[model samples]
Target: MTTLTVFYIGLFYIAAIIFFGGLAYRIYEYSRTPAPLNIPTTPAPTTAGGVVVRMAREVVLFESLFKSNKWIWVFGWLFHVGMAVVLLRHFRYFQEPVWFWVEFIQPYGKYASFAMVAGLAGLWARRFMVDRVRYISTPSDHLMLALLLGIALSGMMMTFVAHTDIVALKAFALGLLTFDWHPLPADPVLLAHLTLVAVLMIIFPVSKLLHAPGIFFSPSRNQVDNPRDRRHIAPWAQALERDNA
Candidate 1:
């Protein structure tokens, strides 16, 4: 048990360091890379309302996914919603006796976990079954999906099928948060589930799953389409321009 605990703790730190270090390097490289010399020649919105509508549709409704393909949009939507619910359910882990609301939502949480696992599986299948998705899919993309599916499946199993000592798990979690190591008697299934979850967290900042944050960095989403008419500049960009000038 001690050896396994040490191994997983070591794996967690190694993965976290590599993932964060790689992400920082990637961002630095991207920052140094020159922007496209050619301006985008896509048709511009003709009216203010049109521009507002376009931005609203893309940001709120994921219009780009719909435009890409309706099925893609549907799968993406389901996967995102399921993920959100599952994340909310995880708050139970930090609380004692769980909260009333969490207890109230326990049934839905189970359903949400099941839905998330199914959604990830469906998305993975869609990636292969659809030609467009298949054409664009990379191994890393598939791995990310597979990892999420594995984590969700393992977590659901822990919640519903496998009996876990929640008290022990909670004690270990609190100990870790307090920077004290209190190793619990190791359950292999719980350990595996936790290891997978830790792996996901470590990889998240580096993966395309980073689009969770990367959406804010997207020029199309973050930058005004009418940059010519409006002097729109990111604060950091403006600072750089001032320093250079």
Candidate 2:
């Protein structure tokens, strides 16, 4: 194996283990930690219809994001759609005899890359140009956006402008999957794109990007807002209490 291959493989394993292990440990610690439940002293929504409307507005319409900043909502939606499309397109790397669906989506992948770059640029621009965003944005936020933009832009260049030998790209990916390391000659542009993607994956679980998973855990979204008189505690929690007693 070439030094480059070895280095990249080592980086991949190290990143995967550390990122996953740390995430697991963090979740374990969070589960063990006791949180004070400040059940709202504020008056609850008087009617079921009102509660349903409010919940629908918050969860479905992203009322919080709209209330905070319309640009945030716009950029956020674009970023997510672009990322999803790009990721799906990457299935070409893994599948031998490139899948028909991948072929079909190739054009969409180009558009997705464009959208991702545009969204990232807009977001970064907002961070600088908007007074509130500038005040609140951290260096990490800027770095993440920059990295994503770099990856998307490089990918776009590879697709539309600077063509790389994608056969070599497939070989390299398959080699990685099969544990048969091959030094496939890839374009520097491709290397930059892959490296940025790797960096994003490594940083993702640790960063605010974790809000992807956090939304499911959100009390407001996941917890049903019914009157305490109407709902009963889960049998599992009651059983656990009985066992403890």
Candidate 3:
């Protein structure tokens, strides 16, 4: 293997460790955190089943975002759905036979980058164009958008502009899974795309990107709004009460 291949193998190993490990720890913390009140947002679900349906809507449809702002919802939904399809399409690289769905989406994923980039551009523009958003926006937000944009643009260049050695690339991806460690193509654009992806993974646990998982644990969104029918006691509070008794 070339030095570049060894370096990337090591880099990806580290990035995977940080990404998965850190995300798991953060999720555990969120689970353990207590909600002091039954404070689901108004018009919230009252039953467990209702909460499930509500969460489904929030996750898949971005219901709250849609209600709050149509433009933001459009951009956010476009980015998320396109990125998801692109990721599903990438499963072709890691699997030997490749699932039928993955094969089917290859053509769609080829063009999904355009939607992804367009969505990112719209979102990035919102930061500058909206006064309240601009006031609260930090450097990290801009940096995250730029990083994603870089990855999408570089990927598009590889697809539409300068084709990389995809056979070699797929070998490298499969190698990572099988511990075989194939040599990676020395294409600069491909390298940049992979590097940006790695960077995004490493930062994801610490960044606002945590919202992807954090939404599930949100008190306002996930709580059942039945305080009147049932006494709301936090797990920690219940323990304390038992000890007192």
Candidate 4:
């Protein structure tokens, strides 16, 4: 393998390790953390089954966000749903025989990039145009958006402007999965897109992007508002009560 190939292989391996390992650790911490209050958001579900339905609406419909800000919610939902489809389409690269659904979605996923980019542009514009959002925006927030925009634009360029060796690209991805290192096409646009992807994966665990997983652990979202029926006590509080008794 050439030096470039070796570097990419190593880079991908490291990114995978960091991404998976970091997510695992973060999830473990979230699971272990105590929520001592029954503080589900208002109009909350009182039952476990009701909570599931509520969460489903929140995840799929962005119901709360829609009620709060229709424009932001529209853009945010479009971006998230587009990203999900795009990710599903990418399964072909890693699979020996891509799933039927993934293959079927290729056309939609191919076009979904436009929605993703448009939504991203809208969100980025908010940071600059909305004084409240702009006031709280940090350097890292803009940097993250730039990284995503770069990845999306470079990918679109490869798809629409410059032709990339996608066959070779799939081979390279599968090779990594199988402990073999295939020479990656050093197409500048492709390289730029992939480098940003790797960086995103590496930083995801520590970044605000973790809100994706952390949402599941949120007390207000996940908790059942049944304090009247059941007393809530944290683990430490339980121990203290035992000692006092």
Candidate 5:
């Protein structure tokens, strides 16, 4: 293997490890954190089943975001859905025989890049255009958007402009899965795309992007509105009560 191939291979391995390991650790921390109050938002679910449905709506439809701000929700939903389709499309590169649905979405995913970029651009613009949003926005927030925009733009360039050797790229992706090394395509666009993806993965656990998982642990979202029906005792509180008894 050439030095370039070795460098990319090592870079990806390190990136994958950091991404998965850090995310897992962060999720574990989230699970262990205490929710001491029944703080579900108004008009929230009262039962576990209702909570599930509510969470589904929040996750898939961005229900809370939709209710809070329609414009932001529109852009956020477009970016999320488009990014999901693009990710699903990438399964073809890793699987030897891609699933039927994955094969079918190729055309949609090819064009979804446009939606992704447009949504990102709108969201980024909001940081500058909206006074309240701009006041609260940090440099890291802007950097994250820039990183995602870079990844999406580079990928579109590879797909619609300067095409790379996708076959070799697929081989490289599969090889990463099986420990069998393959030479990574050294196309500048491809390299830029992959590097940005790796960077995103590595920083995801520490970044604001962690809201993806953190939402599930949110007391305001996940809790049932039943503090009056049944006492809302945290696990630690329960243990203290037991010791007192």
Candidate 6:
């Protein structure tokens, strides 16, 4: 294997392991950490079915955030929805026979970069311009935006500015999946994009990006507002009672 191939293959494997392992650990911890109180946000869903619907609306429409701030909601929605399409489009790279649906959306996904960047720019600007947001914003928050902006811009440059050998890139990606080594296109933008992507994956579970999964564990969102219907007891509190008995 060539040095570049070895380096990337090893780096990807390590990043994959960390990404998945960290997520599993985080998820397990969230599951075990009980919400001792029935603390669902008020004017909230009452039934389990209603909770699911609320969550769906929250995920797809950013309903709550939209009610809070329209501009932030607009930018956040554009970036996230564009990212979903782009990620789906990228599934073609790993598969030997790309799915027909993935192939069909390729063009749309390629251009979604514009929306993604536009949204990120709006969000990044809010950090500088909005006093409350700026006060709470950490260096890591700005750095995360920089990393995402870098990845998206570099990718756009690859697509429109200086196109690389995508065929070779796809082959390299597939080879990594099958343990059959292939040479990567030594394109600087592509390399930079991939490097940023790897860092993003490795840091994702540990970063605020974990809000992706952490949202599922949040008491305000996940808990049903039904204190009258059933008693609420934290697992640790129950355990203490059993020990005393």
Global lDDT scores for all candidate models: 0.70, 0.73, 0.93, 0.90, 0.92, 0.91
Best by TM-score: 4
Question: What RMSD does each model have against the real structure?
Answer: 4.9, 4.9, 1.5, 1.0, 1.3, 1.3
Cα-based lDDT at residue 232, candidate 2: 41
Q: What is the lDDT of residue 20 in candidate 6?
A: 94
Between candidates 5 and 6, name the one with more favorable lDDT: 5
lDDT, residue 243, candidate 1: 98
Error of 4 at 132 (Å): 0.8
Residue pairs clashing, model 1: none
Against the hidden true structure, what lDDT does model 1 obtain? Answer: 0.70
**lDDT of candidate 4 at residue 125, scale 0 to 100:** 96
How big is the positional error of residue 97 in model 4, measured in Å on the Cα after superposition?
Answer: 1.6
Residue-level lDDT of model 3, residues 127-245, one tens digit each, is 99999999999999999999999998998999899999999999999999999989999999999999999999999999999999999999999999999898988888988989999
Candidate 6 residues lying further than 4 Å off, grouped into runs, are 243-245
**For residues 1-245, what per-residue lDDT tens digits would candidate 5 score against the true structure?**
88989999989999999999999999999998888778898788889999999999999999889989988998999999999999888989999889999999999999998889989999999999999999999999999999999999999998899899999999999999999999998898899899999999999888898998999999888988888898877899999989999
- How far is 137's C-alpha from truth in model 6 (Å)? 1.5
Best by lDDT: 3
Model 5: lDDT to the true structure: 0.92
Candidate 2: misplaced stretches above 4 Å? 19-63, 97-100, 227-245
Of models 2 and 5, which has the larger TM-score?
A: 5
Worst 10 residues of 2 by lDDT: 34-43
Candidate 2 versus truth, CA RMSD in Å, comes to 4.9
lDDT for 153 (candidate 3):
93
